[model samples]
Target: MSVPVPKGFSELTNLRSLSGFPVHVDMDASNSWCSLQELEPLSQLRDLTLYGIEKVQDSRMAEKAMISSKRHLQYLKLNYSASGHTIGTCGAEAEQQQQQSVTEEILEKLCPPTCLESFILRGGYVGRRLPDWMCAPESADFKSLRYLMMENLPCCTQLPDGLCCLPSLEGLTIKDAPAIKRIGPQFQASSSVAARGSTASTSAPFPKLRNLQLIGLCEWEEWEWNDCEEHMDVETAIAMPCLERLQIKNCKLSCLPPGLASTKRHTLRELYLYELTNLTHVENIPSVVKLDVFDCPELKKLTALDSRLQKIRIVCCTKLEVLEGVPALDSLVLEDPTMDTLPEYLQAVNPRYLKLDCNKKLYESSSSPGSSEWDKISHIGKRDINCIEDSDTSSDGYSEED
Candidate 1:
């Protein structure tokens, strides 16, 4: 559409920065764009946001705009919102095919220069798959790609195959891909070994990936550890050598992937798992210093907590019956209303802070003068129950602050 610039805004012909150019097609013949052709003159544009991509016309004029030719562009966000006429409508199969074709062509032709440092795909992409160029060929190595985030892509069954091949990539997030039932070999950096710019001696899929977030994957039940059965030998497995922090939220998986659960295999130091109803256990990641579990109803036990763990938070886990072997634990937070009692082992260890944030039933028992719960938790230096606290801070938790 005609994004009316501030009368003379276009006159800043030498401007190095321009932002917020919304593109949308009015379904009713009432409104129309002046064509994406006008953007060709903005030679100095370095950042762009293209919204309402699904609304573009079928003639593919927008594709011919050749966005990738903008050599100086460093950042871009592509937003797509499905139109009224989609796969769910009558005679859907044919209409869906046509739409997918148009979407793929539009994405394929809108290539960004290799200088792009950040890319974001926001909103819904009903197309079942993404265009190939989302992850450029290995020849380019995507040296400047530092961050990538894709969300609301419910119809896409798999992530871009070459996504992690970028040697410079440091952060990644994938959200709300409900149709993705499994994470297969395509996700591992070693799957594209030769293209990783590394010798056959070593392959790092996410060489620089330090932080990762996976959220709202409703149907993802498995993180396939052995996708390439022919090469399933331990030697060919890929590890997250650089990943230090990871978070998984609202997923349908019943267990943690072997890579993220083993400290010997991954470099993860911080982990958070939330709302995973099917998960039954948490264990084996000894490198993690901080661990948090929230709203996971099926998780019944925490086995082999790392000796390096300094802080732990467990909330809303109704069936959690045990926490084993955490000698280095410095702080413990049991905020779940379902926990009627503290673990008996917690009475001996001393920590700087012990927060018991349960409902009135447990909180009252801890507050009663001669109660067993109150006596057991007395060793903790500082105590806060439902926001009320004892000011006696513990030297154990204080000196070991992370």
Candidate 2:
């Protein structure tokens, strides 16, 4: 929520932080609330958050805020309130187009300072394209930025192409963006380099990025990175060299991007996939040490060759058939109350510790010596088999009883 500020608020020139500053405009000049122009004098602010940016009448009003000149500011958030707007209604098409244009113009003038390290964009942004400063050539302005998050972008169809060129970015999160159906090659390399057919470049995309999370992108179905090789040497070009952890939830992608498994094969260590209904296989990511998969009923194959993998947890993946190629696995956890017997893949890999949650009948059989179920898992050094009623399980299949 935004708090109304007095028109004279700018008099506090020594203020170091300001949050929830409201930007509200009235038709009558004398009746307007505090305007963006008032923020021009608060140059000492290090943390700032501006709400209702969509209310600014024009780009000039946004420019008056002089946000780019605040060299000391390190954290900034720009919010666009979608409270009163409704999509797909009568006469809404033309009105939405006009709003999108105005919102784009307003954001262009609200660019943050170059020294800013963290930035967030919240609420519904109506603009079809991000501001110019967030794209090519101009993107170099964010040389010091380390983290960025965009939440609830309902209308954006694509991600900013220049994000791959951010040299200092370490963490990125994009959530609840339903309109994005695919991530194209432009998101893996600079568009300028791809357009010029450059044989070599000094830096790779996402050179320092370490953690990435994508959630609630229900419509996303494809990720394209192989095409980037057409413009650069496949053997020499590298992307996401420093990435270590990746988590994806509620997406429709059938397979992980080829470039990710091929390029990040040595650095990526942890991977988590949840509710990816269309995915069928997980393979070739030899660097991953910990893997978790939940509620992916269609997944049929899981393979990694000569990996450093140590721990694996799988829950509710009913169709899984093959699990192989992890030569150094140490622990394995499986939870499913419906299974009547042990899965065939248990004999393929050898884990020192094995844990299972199953129906009472299977649990009792596995606990008895010389039984078929017990013989199948007898090779494991340590085993803990429990009936469903004896263990407490979370929605994602992880048992709290462990």
Candidate 3:
């Protein structure tokens, strides 16, 4: 249910927090039901959210809100109503261009205060480029911003390059953005850093960022980092110096970025990959202590030379062949009902504890003392294997047959 604000709601000038303030407009009427001008006097706001931003008639009206003037403001969220527009169904090209222009202008005028610590942009933003404040030179305006999330962007083709330069940013998430196809070197360093011809004095990109996630970017296929020798010296440039966790899901990327694996090899601790249909290999991440892989059918090799790696979990990765280079592995878990035999990697890597969720045929072979499957896992200190019976009424299409 939508609640209506009273006629003089802005009269309370002392309010410090506000959320989900809807912008209501009547296209046929001479006057809008609610206008952003109402917020001009509410200068004490410390946190705010504006919903239905797509209904704002023009950039001038948004400028009246004076969001940047609220020095006390620390959090902001701007949400666009879902537009239900996809690639070919957005009507004529001219109309699309007009819509994009209006959206871009409105966002530019709604820049947040410099003290803002967290910001979120949600729904179907159709702009080809992000707001100017989100780009380089202007991005320095957000020196206090600590976190940012952009979701359900239907048309933006690339991430903001300025994000890599944020001095205080710690977490970032970009989800359900289908139009982003590639992440170039610009995403790792600002263009100004490149203009100087050396990174000797330039601070590392993402200096404080610790957690990053990329999900549901189905069209993404490439990430170029180490290949950008013309932009910066790859050997000398440092990035993501404090990163601890990274997750990639439902993307088409064929491999992890070489620069990321090389630069973050000492700071990155956990890696997670899921439903990456085109990914073929994961290798050389020497700092990851935990690795989880699921539903990546095309993955063929996973090699981490890190002595710190202690745990691994793999599920339904049908084509995986080699798993090597973890000398201190403590536990391994494998779950795949379709697999008829133990993976060949088990013969090369010896984990202290092994857990298997397999079908009846595999359990039968492994239970026999003299069988090859039994010989392979007999060296492990502890083992737990669950065999499921083939059946139509089971929860996973198989019932436990203990």
Candidate 4:
């Protein structure tokens, strides 16, 4: 796996971008691997990416690379390719430990400069643990990072600590990280230390985050704060206190981070859920203005829909029968709704616009003059039943039902 860097790479002193370097250590003492230290001369690098990091075994050499010297760099991506390796046997396990130890040291040395604004780590790291440098709230100026993405690290049991809490992070996306089961205060410990006992109120994690997405986490079950060892009281905890939008898709998580979930009461404005079959109940969301649920066949009810929730679009949620909290909704859009019966309080929602994306017979019984649904929706000024079209797009289909 030891690949030598081109002999003249260092001579490219003015390189503005460099990527796909494969530096490695060989089993023979006679063989030589290119040292990462060669990159220090590329001072003008604005974007740098390192691929095949698992092959680099000389931790000291990596440490001397001085990646932090590139003050002009704004974007960095690190890749580790462990493609055909298997960790099934004793010998393989030992080798992983050795590789990871050196990898961790190299990563520690390759910390990006404070001016870095975007970072991505795409890997299939099967090592027992990730490098310590991945953890955020580092002594380094990691607060300058605005956009963060971690993808394809399927065996990574936990995400980097406090990643969501970065003071300047505006967009965060985590995909294909199957091992992450929870994201709570435990992950934010490193950054929370300074605020531990101070009574002075501080900004919460995800304070400036506007968009947060979690996808393809197969083992995720809960995001409950009561399950963690955090010292903050839930009633006062302002986690994700400034979040504007959140999306959870293709995950097995039946629940959300309690701290993040609590923010729905006042901070969260929009929520989108898709293909989360195990997610059956959603309650206590009092402030969400736009809520969209799709293809979650197991979801039987919205246990508590906020009274002021302005709009809701439900698609293919076959088991959902109740929408208890939406007593004052302004618009209701349904497509492939499986509920055989509607909530008794349907009249209370009093939606001015009701659009049903079905075969027009959806409310056959209720469409009649004396039916309860007729009485329930008769007050709606705008109602329409359009044939279902695309599943991914919205269907306003607002026709005046005279």
lDDT of 1 by residue, 139-203 (tens): 23567988889888767887776776676788999988888888875676463453644455444
Candidate 4 on 166-285: residue-level lDDT in tens?
A: 678888888887777776555544345433343455455555677888888767776645323255465324556567788998877675555544533376789999889788877766
Instruction: Report the lDDT tens digits of candidate 2 across residue range 53-125.
Output: 7778688889989999998999999887877433456768898788778878888899999899999998877
Each prediction's TM-score versus the true structure: 0.84, 0.89, 0.89, 0.77
Clash counts per candidate, in order, are 3, 0, 0, 1
- Candidate 3 clash total? 0
Give the total clashing residue pairs for model 2. 0
When 1 and 4 are scored with lDDT, the better candidate is 1
Looking at model 2, report the run of 10 residues with the lowest lDDT sum: 393-402
Q: Which segments of candidate 4 are over 4 A away from where they belong?
A: 1-6, 19-37, 81-92, 95-105, 136-140, 188-203, 226-237, 261-265, 337-348, 359-378, 388-400
Q: Which has the higher lDDT value, candidate number 3 or candidate number 4?
A: 3
Please write out the lDDT profile of model 3 over residues 306-402, one tens digit for every residue: 7789899998898999999988999998888788888888888888888887787887787777899877787777777777554321322222222
For each candidate, the alpha-carbon lDDT, in order, equals 0.70, 0.81, 0.80, 0.68
Return the TM-score for candidate 1, rounded to 2 decimals: 0.84
As a whole number from 0 to 100, the lDDT of residue 145 in candidate 4 is 84
Candidate 2 lDDT for residue 195 = 24
- Regarding TM-score, does 1 or 4 come out ahead? 1
